[model samples]
Target: MIAVSDNLPAGARQPTESGDCIDENDARQAANWVAETLERLSRSSFRSSFTLSPHDAEYARRKGRELIDRHAHEMLAQRVGAAQPAKDGRQTPWRGHPVFTAQHATACCCRGCIEKWHHIPRGRELSAQEINQLAGLIMAWIDRDLAAHPAVTGERDGWAAPPENPKDAGAEQGGATPQPRRRSDAAGHLERSRRHPDNHHADGASGFIQGELL
Candidate 1:
């Protein structure tokens, strides 16, 4: 299970605050890496133009969240100094998800970069809490990048479009639908109000007008 505290084993460095796992400085560095990587890739004639589709972006987010849930221990082992061998005893193959790509780009993928870029030096195993926080930072960076550059076809600039009338969402589900009042009803209400302001108050004609407009 992933721990959510900064508590660490003795001889390990105290973890940074969870909220500061991915700060403005980290985000800035990720952005620069993203820009430079793409620009460099563009120069390669053999490099195909590849951008993550909406499906790919969604997959990356889902996988990232799932990784944090199911693979925290393994991730920590690989990231920190567990010295665990791979299944084939060589090296674990990198998962080609965009979040992984972003993790590499953002220097959040391993302890070496985490130490160099994030200032989290490696001497002892990372606490589960730290691993979880690192996962969150990588996921956040992936989400931020995806939001900034959306897939061309599915959404507008990585944001889902708002419904025409957001307030009317409830109206679809057994809510009282407001019926438009006829012109005659409006005219009659006006006449009643004009004929007697005191009478209008007494008969609640003003109230009727308010209800009708709504």
Candidate 2:
């Protein structure tokens, strides 16, 4: 795995309000939190299992980072930013978008997971700064996934070559491609139960217990 520090440019610290969420404006702290969080997440089999499929990686490349980041922010804000999201734990789907997978892998999928893994408290709407931090982390994961899988851009292994113009890439695909099968609730519960005992904790504290918030 590429070191998280390698992906981010080093910068001097800046003042900010005290909070558990990483200060997105502080480049150094954000980089460290991302690196540490990723490292901790890697120790969990479930989190490590999530990856950007060739198609998803290609989709991200075509959409460009700006659009992907926008999608992440929008999803996070709509699905998770609310204090009492309509469905809470069931809000984020197990598939359909790259950010969804990233959310699961990074433990940013629900309020419970966010509180446990990210130290972001629940019972109140996520602050704008907190939302930005979460978005940054999600984007960092996507960036890492893309960097790790360069073959997605090449015309090999059933993957199509990237188009010269990103906007034109969608038309080249003909139409909207079908997403992979969504994970059934039963399957998700089963997987979580199977992996619960093996979940990794940060700082020796207990890790997220799947279905706890469901």
Candidate 3:
């Protein structure tokens, strides 16, 4: 987990009450490791044709770092009404702080890895069972890491719950009930969520009229 700091950039989003650049990096590493670590997960957990190249990994990492530097700390500042995250010249990551730390400290955040875990970005390209299997692999990876990591195991206050599996939308998480939105999401939103499009993963073109992603 990253320490909270006085480092910040101009025109950044406000920081949250609490911050964790360290945690963000951990999640990034974990996500990447998870993708590579458990290559034997069920076929449904991974697409036979899908694979991440070294170039792809590097590109994603760089983008993740850019995202963290540009928007993460500021968002943290606003969340807790706290001071913005100050720049520390530390290495950046794909996952940002505040929210990333707010999530599981051990859960992975490498977008490429998560893509393997859920295959949501490519969901439309595959079957439902494949997606569920992919999600399960991700779930299993996080559970295993949480059981193994010191920060996750020995702490009562630092550890938080992981996100509900989309496949288990109606399932319980850690003995707690889950709630889901009643309405189906917009196609454009789904596309944005999946990080579709060529230029970037940003929601969509800014100031442009929205259209159905599919």
Better of 1 and 2 by TM-score: 2
lDDT of 2 by residue, 1-214 (tens): 8754434334434433323433346666778888988888787656776777555676767667766777888788898899988777667766557787788878888787898778898789998778777888898888788777774345533333375554434542213445554353533643663344333322243554443321
Give the alpha carbon lDDT tens digit for every residue of 82-184 in model 1.
Answer: 4322221112212334544444434444454455445666555666555655555555555555667653433333343222344433432112244333232
Please report, in order, the local distance difference test score of every candidate based on alpha carbons: 0.42, 0.67, 0.30
Measured by TM-score, the strongest candidate is: 2
* Regions more than 4 Å wrong, model 3: 1-93, 96-124, 151-214
Model 2 has an lDDT value of: 0.67
The order by descending lDDT is 2, 1, 3
Among all windows of 10 consecutive residues in model 3, the one with the lowest summed lDDT is 82-91
Query: Which sections of candidate 1 miss by over 4 Å?
Result: 1-55, 61-95, 151-214
Q: What shift in Å separates residue 126 of candidate 1 from its native position after superposition?
A: 0.6
- Candidate 1 lowest-lDDT run of ten: 85-94
Name the lDDT of candidate 1.
0.42
